[model samples]
Target chain A: MRIAAQAVLYAAFVAVIGYFSTSPAYVHLAPGEAVVKLSLSHAGERKEPCRTRSEAELAKLAPNMRSPTVCTRERVPVRIVVAIDGTTIFDVVAQPTGLAKDGASTVYRRLTVAAGRHRIRAELADAPGGRMTYSATTEVDLAPGRLLVIDFAPEAGGFVFRS
Target chain B: MRAALAASLDACEAAFDRAFGQAGNPWRHLGSLAFLLVVVTTATGIVVYAVYDTSVGGAYRSVRAMSAGPPAGLALARSVHRYASDALVLTMIAHLAREWLRGHAAGFRWFSWLSGVPLVALVYASGIGGYWLPFDRLAQLSLTATTEWLDALPLFGEPLARNFVSPASVPDRLLSLLVFLHIGIPLALLAFIGVHLLRLTRPRSFPPATIAAATCAALVVLALMHPARALAEADFGSEPMTVAFDWPYLFIHALQYRTSPQLLWAAAGAAGLVLAVLPWIERTPHAPAACVDLANCNGCGRCFADCPYAAITLVARSDGRHLPRQAEVDPRRCASCGICAGACPSSTPFRSGSDLATGIDLPQAPIRALRASLDRALETLAPRPAIVVFGCASGVEVASVREPGTAPIELVCIAMLPPSFVEYALRAGADGVMVSGCREGDCAYRLGHEILRARLEGSREPRLRARVSRARVRTFWGARADARSLSAAVAAFRRDLAASPRAAGPSMPPKRREALDA
Candidate 1:
């Protein structure tokens, strides 16, 4: 009788956990959508201007500490926009990665779109002004459930794409 | 002061044993139970890992989807994983506390205790890494506090807290590192567990099946009742209004809000150092390890198998004997419980030789001396139906049980008593044999009382013969504080013996029957 009671208790325990762990209902979505991923390794270089020291400013400096000029330590934020077939879908400004907020900026995003993209236009601005520092335009056909990637390479001096 | 504290702890442990019956008791096997819980946590963690997204941006969404979206079992599995981690910490603490309180944290037992200190740190690291995987508000708080703590050390050139300052600052690789640590530390913990059990002859890697099942069942019930869910997405710009802490593993993080992290680390480091060096702090002289008498040893390997500390090994005999091997003892590993002597077939008390010896025996208290003591105790008993009470020296003191017709004899541990001694005492005119040892699960030599009990119950090797009437024997477990109860047990045994029919009537030998009848 004791064994039977223990067995019943164990069975009840398993049942309750089993009931809570499994979903009785779920929604399954159709699978024809494609994803476009964009990644920026480093935002374009800073656009802050350097100022030359005046004669009086140089006179106050120590003999060993003299230098040409002083430049701003802040970095330009990277602003990016993505357009598919003349329709803009993604736009955001990504800040630099550091405790002082002066390091290089990086971005990674995934945008889901209907299959068979006609044309894709991407732009990025790393300066304080809203000027396109880099731009890429390409025409490509996207397959169902495919992933298209757009990444920036400083050495290449432009955006690169792979599908 | 230390002695007083130890005495009080022993008293408390004895009280606990009396309140809770020994058999199937979970507290008796906390270390094994903790190992079992780790297995449960790992099993559930593997399920959660299947749906985990390692990317920083998708990590939070994937977790939220798992707990709130489809595959309903996923959420429950996640909760089980969380609760089991908490349960594992709880059991590990209890196991540590029990060992400390019972005074098993020092001397030769120090290796097991010291190895466990690092295990606590590893479990904490693994648990916190699990929390960091979801990228929720709580995870963010945990990550921030952990980074702040890490930054206090001079090892890193850049403060790690910089990584979590903003979403852009945190990289997907950071999440990968967390996953790697969560998996890697536990594997390291598994290796440490192997080292922890290396000294023991037969370590119980897992608890009894029923206890394991019960622990899992309890974890499941907890998971169902209080399912774990991911909090809101971490917003770096916003200050955390509140953070729920799992106290078992996150109490140190909670301390970060009130005290300096350096102070917390200092206190924790000091405590860990003390725990690691406890064996040296409370050094006590242990009995000399057992020695093997190769002349009497036939190399049965029984002593080697029965050694609780794995101190004995069988080596090839050099004397050109028919038997292939002989027993050898490792002094450092042996606790000198003399259980090997009990397992020796030559340990039977029926030997008539003037100098009695066993194949393997403790030098301090050899089998011949023990047999001599037993014979003397039986010879001194009164003419009435007498009872021979066997007690452990480490347990209740035998000298205190002053029953008129009962003769008390003490051994290094009751486990050193060969089963045939009970029959020998009975045939030598004792009416009853009463054996006692340290309270259940509180054996001074780890498994002494357990092995003794199994032998008496006929389940283990060298069991008591069936001819020995079960009714003529009784076993009682008690501690130093249990003297009065032990006395009462002896008195009750006397009454039972008086009530039963005398065995010295017609079935006995004529001369021996005359001596008893007179």
Candidate 2:
């Protein structure tokens, strides 16, 4: 009888394992991307394009952040606002805006995507030469799409884009 | 010194049996199962760590590499870790529930209640730490969420997460410390498990092989389907992460992220703590046998001997009256198994107040109820020769003795059977309904079977030249190993069922399963 009871328990253990293995596990990333909007209302005409920000960028954008990283391009101070599509993905270091040409001090962040072509864009939140916004958008092929975004400008104050 | 030590050891071993040999000691078995899982987790954790890297960038990639690397021990190790954890949880819940159900948690056993809370906490902490090692996007996110949550507590001034999130700000040493804590906590759990079993007299180690096999198989399936991977290499400042459920631990994260964090934590924590203390808090009014009057106490240590828990102590008193020894009941260990009442002498004025036999009596109403219950259960059995065997819950395995062709029935308690029901079965031409019970004083349900047996035995009355009885119910006590006893009782009942004149009286309707399944 004892042996039989042991056998029954052993069978139950096996069945339990079989049950769990077949069940799917739910997975999610923290500080994941969420679409947001930045309204640029000139003369009460609002052109608010949706932008996305990584959590770190949001923190720097936060009112209380101290000593946020700054990105410099061609010896010019540039603070760029990163946006996926039209949404601001991140606000550059210490409220940095625009792009930089110098690769050093470029702000890069990682994002995960499903396998497919994804549009990644970096636009100038605030730039020199009359609020110039040097913007770039491109479709990159990704398998379980993952990429690092690096936005640049010639200097901290200047940019190439006219719009 | 050696001789004295051996003598003490021998004496302790003897006392161990005396203390824990009774029923409801399965907690000892639960402790053993917990120990095995701890061992598996430690052994597997070491192997994963040897090839593991703590470098901020390398941590995630290293885990992925290990998962994809030599499939040798990795699969087995992962399965063992996963399933053993599941098994650990299952055993803990079962052990905890059983204690509550048996009312062992009430009274002085509250220490087991308090210590159990920490064990549960440790399970969650260590389980979360395991997911962090995977270093996938999900792992990264989990770390962020957990650390951020931890930082919410006043324990840490600044966000504790800041130490691990940024590239330069976060150090490998801090990451290593997290890893150390992760590995160390299970060891702490092991220590707690030791303390958990210390009070238990007999510790049963190793779960039955089937349970282990089921646990292993389920884990293997999980590992295969998900194939533990790093969703993406760990990069500081990366907000987008892929997260997967750890099932046990992830549910908390899921609840927090999807709903309100404070609410989830508060509700879950409170509910879990309450459940942990429930066994201790619940007080069921057992039959009158539980109450003992000191004045009615007899010198005979019958109650002391009958108690499954060593709750009763026979104290020698110098009172000059009728009794020399009085049975003192301890609120601490007394499970209230009232065998002492039956053993008390009838002539003594202070016989045991508990009448286990009275509770066992099958009055007419309960007998009809038992009949209805049997009718309901038999609806699933084939319309062939079926013997309904109603054994005490603890003696359920006795149903295995039913002849290959016979079907068995289950009941909550054997005392629910009335004498008329057995006569009704005989009148219906059905086979006997045998009520198998646990050994005399070992009933987990406290004298349930003893009462029923006494009622049946007491019904025996003599007639002219022969003894005639209305109900031909056969009652037997089943010892744990007495397969022979089980067989003899069933065999006798089977012969009686076959030989009875009512064998072909009425045919039972076809059971419902065939039509339902079809």
Candidate 3:
């Protein structure tokens, strides 16, 4: 009886290995990127954050960057904002970095940048380092921006980053 | 019909115990502690390789870093991985050979033989996967050889090696599949281990001090030496570098490179089948049933429960306590786990006695306790010419621990004292600890001295200088009653300590080296 059981187990083991050996799917992600989408509903029923694609709306950044201005990991928080000039050349979604903090760090619009001064202000994600803000202006020249809000959060989050 | 069924069942029960008698053997289990470490290795490897990226150059460094990294778990995990692999293969081989020698693996058990072949294959598959992860020169060559061999099979369409040219030429997805196999194979190996333990009561675990110290020391040394650096990332097209083989399993791979892969597989499979069916093929003669030491019996019911056959039953004794009652071991119904013997507090106080038991006698539990006491004493003692003294159970007990004196502390069986406690004593400010057990075979427990001797020799740890050198904590085995032997052992150890220069007394926080050593 033990021998029979051993045989059955061995066969099952082989079958599992043979099947999965061909290929297996896995999760992939880069460091420091947090992906989030908001769910808001004006009517009675609940709904997902499914704002549809309209050329005009996709082209513009959210004007109220200060309202939802905090992003955190653990207790640390990073406050930042996304701003763009009238010229549109880069898609916010394509940009892996730079997003706004409304207690969150996610981009919502496609903004273009060229070789000139542009300011993206950010603060430490949490306390002890609160009230600290850093701003830098850099040049960017690339394809004309499309509708993408490259969402980002500050390093202040308690999220322990694995290097 | 009922009578015939009963007779057949009896026969089966007897046969069962006849097969697994060694499961009760402490030496066998002591040896198998290696299995515990190996299991740890496979588990850690599965986790590390799971997250590994399989691209060319990246795969090697990533695996190297993961295996040798400073991460809290990575280095320890890799050590466990290697040790476990070595231990599993060693024990499996030992288990097979012991079965063959005992004539328990033959005849009607052919199915076990055949099934075991796949398990052996899976072990090799996991081993190869480990080799591949390093992506070192040898790793690339090994993979190339493997792929080339696969291509030789009529079923394969193309030579996969053609893709090794440029980074873009090789498909990352396909490489990912190989990495997946590397991860998946070990997880699959775990299933085999589960099956292996199904029929047994408890799978063996590593002996804490010996196994832990040996495994850690081995890893530290290996890390200091080879450091497990990766060879160049595997290129599908490049010719592999020539290298030595890992004798454990890859010997066959090297042979395959010389001969035909098909022939190698056929030979391996055939050999494995023979081994698996060995228990049934070889027949062990039935011996008389084991006698019970009822006086020592605590009525633990271990023997009663351990018996695979219904030969032993628990019945009310004169004092109204339940004890195992003997009945005929209807020869047809037994599989000798002697778990009864191992579990039997009566028949086996510490040692096992089977219908056909191994001649090794283990010291009783009291002796083991005495040894542990000696260990505890050294651990609690303060610095002196800090020295640990061990004396056998039958040896003279000193009136009291003479502070800074040259007398041995008595113990029943030194095997019960672990090496770590000695090291711990040194860290706590003891100069050294010493142990004395009975002379070789003369020990009342036949193998007590031998077992203690093996452990003492194996107890060496570099970081704990006080633990390793004879001047520090050391061990000697002689008749417990032999004052001359005890005095000489103590004198020698004391002389060594006194001759050596003493360091300043213990300071705050101790030294950095001792803290980081483990």
Candidate 4:
């Protein structure tokens, strides 16, 4: 009788392990849909351009940090917006990823849409201005289960779309 | 609410104890069982780790082929790693909860408890790293979610989530870093485990063979029943319709997506803070440490040998007297349980009350006071067949065994009752003596049961006198819930005492009472 009970307990223990080891599927996106992922990791242009400091200004600084060319590591926050078929699908004002605002401003947002051909428009603004720094408008046919990756690479021109 | 939880834990333990018996009870061996699972996990992982390709493009294919087995041993090996790892994490959590609930996080255990806070994080880091080696859709999701969560903190100047943005952005060398991290972090965890066990003397690091075998068998059966297979190969540009998540390791990923990473970090930080400071929340109740009497100590080194904590050490006797060595207590590590006093030969109750000093003893519960308590208890023990019970505070309720013509003398632990005390009670007019304590492997003072056992069996110092009738003595080691078994043992001892022709040891000395009163 004790053996029977132990067997039962052993079975229950294994069942729990089996159930939790891998189960309860996580659905990331709805069926018959494609994703338009706006992925950006770019350092924004400086809020203010570098300026040559006066000799007095340089002398006032600590000996280790003092320099004639005063270029701040802090960069301007970047604002980005992406629209698909004239509908604004993704929009964000992303701050640089550091405590001192001295690093690249990154944006990784996914927009789910129906699988079809659509006109995509993307824009980026590096400074606090109505003027745009980079913009691209393109037409791409996106199939279901495929990702339309909208990425930023200054060397390859801004807002390159990879489908 | 805590009391309710404790009572429920007790109930569950009692139920399991009956089914598995004391030796096989998982509740009794939670810490050791977790260690066994760790060993199992490492063994299986070494096999799979040696065989699997650690490249991003090749890892998923290799793991998938390993799972869809032509070689059953390799397939089983991979499955066992996953299963054993899952079991390892769950068992560790269970072990932590049991220790916390039992109020083991406070007092001398402060260091052990505080060091364990990082162990929880290490377990997650190690387990999540294990999943990433497969490079399946689940691994993709885990890696991406983990990086995004980590990105919320400013530790990295640039966001880490950029690596998961597109398939092109993820470098081939990234898998190498992940492999290095998976191996390196667990080695750090192993070092921390060493630190955790440092304070404990004679640490029980392995479960009994029966438990180890059963645990392995259970995992093997689980692996056979449901072989662990990888999800479809990862594509950063795509997501699987639904991915099967390893809930043990990937639950954090689930929670991160469900809530903001900042909120999750806040919760984790709050929990870590609470756990780190939990030891100081309550003060140690039994605070009086053991002290040594230089004059009475012959420096036999018995107390030093019997100390469960490495608290007592032998040093050259400070006084110019020609003693070989003397016991010194480091009060910080001393438990003040009086097991050391029990092992001290000078702790014999036969000492006169005017100068009842032992070599080493708890100032709070001196063996002299125990002798006085014995005297008072024995004087009142009514009826012809009086039985005196010796038990411990941390064991069964000693007072609960009190009955007609029966009385109990409680000590801090059963080992605190010197073997001479049994003979003293027998000579002082008690018909029989019964020594009881915590169950065999569940000693509150760790070595109390073993020390007392050897002493009574005449195998250790201050041995029970052979002239004392063995039939008139009884010993029962029972769990706290085993009061019924204790009562039954007492009843049987009473019957045996009645059957025997009242062979009481030599009569008490006539002038001993005057010396005791003086």
What iRMS does model 4 reach? 2.1
Candidate 1: clashing pairs of residues: A21-B73, A22-B73, A23-B72
- TM-score between candidate 4 and the true structure: 0.91
Best by lDDT: 4
Clashes per candidate, residues 3 or more apart or on different chains: 3, 44, 75, 0
- Give the winner by DockQ: 4
The local lDDT score (0 to 100) that residue A149 gets in candidate 4 is 86
DockQ in order: 0.03, 0.10, 0.01, 0.56
- Evaluated against the true structure, the overall lDDT of model 1 is 0.77
Among all windows of ten consecutive residues in candidate 2 chain B, which has the lowest summed lDDT? B459-468
Which docking band does candidate 3 fall into?
A: incorrect
Write candidate 3's Cα lDDT for B69-138 as tens digits: 7634565555446545654565566555443433334432233333455666787787776766666655
Output the number of the TM-score-best candidate: 4
Q: What TM-score, to 2 decimal places, does chain A of model 3 have?
A: 0.23
Q: Which scores greater on TM-score, model 1 or model 4?
A: 4
lDDT of 2 at B404: 57
lDDT of 4 by residue, B1-518 (tens): 88788788878877887788865778778777877877788888888888778777888888998888743588999998898889888888888888887888888777878888888888789889999899988888888888878878867665687787778878888888998998898888888888887777777788878778888998898898899987888898775557887888888777876777888899889988988889888655757889998988878888888888788899998987898888898888888889889988898877655657888888888888888888888877877578999987887887888898788888988998889999989988888999999877677777788889999999988799898888878898876777788888888888777777574443766567677555
* TM agreement with the true structure for every prediction: 0.73, 0.50, 0.40, 0.91
Per-candidate local distance difference test: 0.77, 0.51, 0.44, 0.83
